[model samples]
Target chain A: MRLYLAYFKIKFLNEIQYKVAALAGIATQFAWGFMYIMLFTTFINNSDTNAISSSQIVTYIWLQQAFYMLFAFWSVDKDIFDSISSGNLAYELTKPVNLYDIWFIKTLALKVGKTVLRALPIFLICMLPFLGEFTMTAPVSIMAAVWFVITMFFSTILILSYIMIIYILTITAISPLGVKITFSLMGDFFSGGLIPIPLMPDIVQTILKYTPFYYIQNIPYNIYNGYISGNLEIIKIVGIQVFWIVILIALGKLLMKNSMKKVVIQGG
Target chain B: MIELKNITKTYRVRKRSAGMKNAFKTFFKKDYEVIKALDDISFEINEGEMVGYIGPNGAGKSTTIKIMAGILTPDSGQANISGLIPWKQRTKYVKDIGVVFGNRSGLWWDVPVDDSFELLKNIYKIPDDVYKQQKTKLVKLLDIGEIIKIPTRQLSLGQRMRCEIASAFLHKPKIVFLDEPTIGLDAVSKIAVREFIKKINKEDKTTIILTTHDTQDIEALTNRIILIGKGKILLDGKLSDLKKKFSKKYLTVEFNGDIDQLCDGLIFIEKYKGRIIIELNENILTLAKAIAFLTSKIEILDLEVDNTSVDDIVVKLYQEYGI
Candidate 1:
C-alpha cells in the first residue's frame, strides 16, 4: 500500500509539472463547453418534451466540461507504453510489487490530479457573468449529493478498468493506436460527454444504458442533477455501476494475466 | 549462491524484404524467424564472488542477465539463486537482487534523485533507519551528494550513471547484475565506477555479474570471466588462466651481429638497425634455449621478453571460436 502511494505521489508530481499543458486544456474545454451549451439550448428551444430541461442540459454540459479530464478517453497513463518501448519494463518487472496495481495507482493519480487542477478553473470560468447560465446547480438534496459521490467513485474504477483493457491490448495487438482512437471516439460519443444521454433518441439511450461507457459520465451527472431521486432508483443505478466495475475488472485481470506471459521488451 | 542449468531462451523475430510489394505482403502475412538468444548455458557463482561476463554484440549477455534478474523467463531451464528460482519467485527473489542496464534510465527524468530514492526506499520496504544508513553510505561512496538534489534530466551522463549505480545499491541487494555499466563513460568516470564496484564487492561481500565489451573493465574488475558466443558459454575460468592459454611470448634483441636465417622454431618478425624481434612458442622452443641460441649467434646489446596482453588473448579466443 505504501509503495502504491509512492507511485501515486510521483505521478501526481510529474503530471503537475506540465502547468502550461494544464492551462491550455482548461482553455480548450471552456471553448467546447460554450459551443455545446449554445447547441443544446437551440435544440431544447425546438423540442416540447420535458424529459430533460434546457437548464439541465446546460448544467450537464458545464459539469462534463469541468470534469473533462475524468470523462475523456485520453491516454491517462502513457508511461506504460513508454516503458515497454524503452525497455524499462524489464526493470519495472523486477520490482517487488504487482505491475498491474502500480500502473493502476499511477493512472488514477494522473486523472485525479489533473482533474483537480482543471475542474475548479473551468467551473469558475463557467460561473462568469457571460456564462453564468451554464454553471452547475448544487445537488437538489443531501441524498442526491451522497449518491452523486458514490457514482463518481464507481465511475473512476470503471474507467480505470477500461484503461486497463487498453493497456493489455497494447501488448497483444499488432497496433493499439487504431484501437485507442476508436475507443476514445466511441467513449466520447456514447458516454454523454458530447451530448447528454437523456436528450438522445430513446433507442440510442437504451443501447447506451447497457454499455459501460454510459456509467462513466452519464450516471454521475444524472445523480448530481437529482434526476435519480428515489431511494430504489438510486440503489438500482449504483448496483449497475458496481456490476460493470466487477465485470470490467475481472476481464481486465484475465487479459492482463494472459498478455503478460508473452511480453517482449522491444529494445535493449 | 547462484546456479543455472541448461537455461535456453528463443525469440521469434518478424522478417520482411525491402520492396514495397514485399512490405505490403508482409503487412498481410508476416514471416517470423526463431532466434536462440540463450542455448543450454549453465554456470555457478558462489557468494561474494565477482565475475565478468564478456561477449560481442548479440551474444546473449543481456539475455542471461535478464533471466537471472527475474525479468525474463527462459524457454526451458533451471535458475536458482539464493535457493529461489528467479522466474518462478520473481517478486520475492528480486528483493535480494539489483539490475542496471546501461542503455536505460531507472530514475525518473523529471524528479530529483532524492525523490526517486525515497520512492525506491518504500518499494523495497527498507526500514527507515536502514534506508537512511544505506543512502548516506552510497551517496558518499559515489560522491554524489551535490547532484542528488537535482533533476535527473539536468545531469550529465557520468553523473546520471553514478546516481543509477548508487540507486541500485540503496536497498543493499545481495547480488547485482551490471550490464555494460561503463559503456560510453569517459576514462575518469569509468575508473570511478570501477572503484565503487570494487569497494562494494569487498566491503559488503556483494556478488556481482558484469557484462561489458571493454576488456579494460574486465581487467580492472574481476578475476574470473565467462565468455559467451552464439548463445552458448564458450569459456569460463580465471582471467589469468585464459591469458595463459592464448598468450604468446615475444623476445626482442639488439645485437652487433645476426644471421639472415633463424632456427626452425623461431620466426623472425622484424629487423631494424641491429635489433631483431622473434616470436617464440613456449611449447616448441624453451625460453632458455632461445636465449642461448641468440646469445651464441650474436653479441647482444639489449634484450626484452614480453607476453601478449589480455585484450589480445580475448581477440584470439574470439577468432578461434569463430564468433
Candidate 2:
C-alpha cells in the first residue's frame, strides 16, 4: 500500500506540472458543458416525457463537466500507453512491485490530479446565479450528499478496473490505437458520457444496467441530484456499484495475468 | 549465486516485405518468423564476480539479462539465483537485484532525482536510516549531490546516468545487471562510472553482470568475459587467457638498410622509407629470434614490439564464430 502511495504521489506531482494544459482543459470542459446543456434544453422543453427535470439535467451536465477528468474513459495517460508501446515498460517490470497495481495507482493519481485542477472552478462557475435556470443546484439533502460521495468513490474504482482491462489488452496488442479507440468509444457512449442514461431508450438503459457501465457516472450524478432517492434505493444502488466493482476488478486481473504471461517488450 | 542451464528464448517477429502492397497484405494476413534469440545458453556466476556479457546486435544479450532480472520468462531454462527462480519468484527475486537499461530511464522524468530515490526507498521497503545512509553514499560516490536535487529531465545524459546507477543501488541489491552503462559517455564520465562500479563491486561484494560493446569497459571493470554470438555462448574464460590465446607480436623496425627478404615466421605488414612492420608468429619464432633475424638482415636503429589489441581480438573472435 505504501509503495502504491509513493507511485501515486509521484504521478500526481508529475501530472500537476502541466498548468497550461490544465487551463486549456478547464476551458474546454466549460465549453462542452454549455453546449451539452443548450442542446438538451430544447429536448426537455419540447418533450412530454419528463424522465428527469430540466434542473436535474443542468446539474448532471455541470457535474459531468466538473468531473470530466475522472469519468472520461478516453483520457488515459499517453505516457503510460507510450511506455507499453515503446518497450520502456521493461524498466517498470524491474521494480519489486505488482505491475498492475503500479499502473492502476498511477492512472488513478493522474485522473484525480487532473480532476482537482479543473473541477473546482467549473463547480463554482456552474453554481453561479448568472446561469439562471441552467445553474447547477446543490445536493437534495445531507444524506444524499453522503451517498453521492460513497457511490462516486466506488464508481471511479469500477471505471478504473474497466480501463485496466484496456491497458492489459494493450500489452499483447500489436497496435494500441484500435484497442484504445474501440474501448473508449464504447465505454464513453455506454457510461453516460455521450448522453445521460435516463434520456436514452428504455431498452438501451435496461441493457446497460446489466453491464458495469450503467453504474459508472449514471448512478452517482443521479443520486446527487435527487433523481435516485430514499435510503432503500440508495443502498441498492450502492450495492450494485460494489458488485460491479468486484466483478470488473476480477475480470481485469484475470486478463492482466494472461496478458503478462505472453508480454514481449518491443525493443532492446 | 546465480546459475542458468539450457536457457532458450525464441521471438516471433512479424515479417513483412517492402512496398505498400506487402504492408496491406500483412495487415490482412500477418506472417511471423521465429528467431532463436537464446539457443541453449548456459553459464554460472558466483558472488562478487564481475562478468561482462557481450554480443553483437540481436545475439540475445538483453534477453539473458532480462531473464536473470525476472523481467523475462524463457521458453526452456532453469535459472536459480539465490535459491529462487527469477520469473517464478518475480517480486521476491527482483528485490535482491537491480537492472539498468542504458537507452531507457528508470527514474521519474519530471521529478527531482532525490524524489525518485525516495520512491524507490518506499518500493523496496528500506528502513529510514538505511535509506538515508544509502542515498548519501550513492549521491557522494556518483558526485550527483546537486544534480539529484534537480529534475531528471534537466540533467545532462552523463549526470542522469550517474543518478540512474545510484537509483538502482539505493536498495543495495545483491546482483546488478548493467546493459551498456557507459554507452555514449565521454571519457571522463566513462572512467567515473567504471570507478564507481568497481568500488561498489569491491565494497559490497555485489555480483555485477555488465553487457557492453565497449571493450574498454570490459577491460577496465571486469576480468571475466562471456562472449555470445548468434544466440550461443562462443567464449567464456578469464580475459587474460583470451588475450594470451589471441595475442600476436607485431615488430616495428626502423632500419637504415632495406631488407631484401624475410623469414617464414615474419610476415611483412608495411614497408616505409626507413621503417618496416612485421607480424611475428610467436608459435613459430620467438620475439628474440625475430629481432635476431631482423638485425642480421638490416641494421636496426630502433625496434618496437606490440601485441594484438583487445579490439582486434574481439573482431577476430566475432569472425571466428561467424556471427
Error of 2 at B231 (Å): 1.0
User: Which portions of model 1 miss their true places by more than 4 Å?
Assistant: A128-132, B251-266, B273-276, B282-306
Name the best candidate (by lDDT).
Answer: 2
lDDT score, candidate 2, position B262 = 89
DockQ of every candidate structure: 0.68, 0.76
Candidate 2 lDDT tens digits, B222-269: 899999998999999999999889999898889898786888898989
Residue B176 shift from truth in candidate 1, angstroms: 0.9
In the predicted model 1, the residue pairs found to clash are none
Give the range where candidate 1 chain A is weakest over 10 consecutive residues by summed lDDT.
A259-268
The deviation in Å at residue A125 for candidate 2 is: 2.0
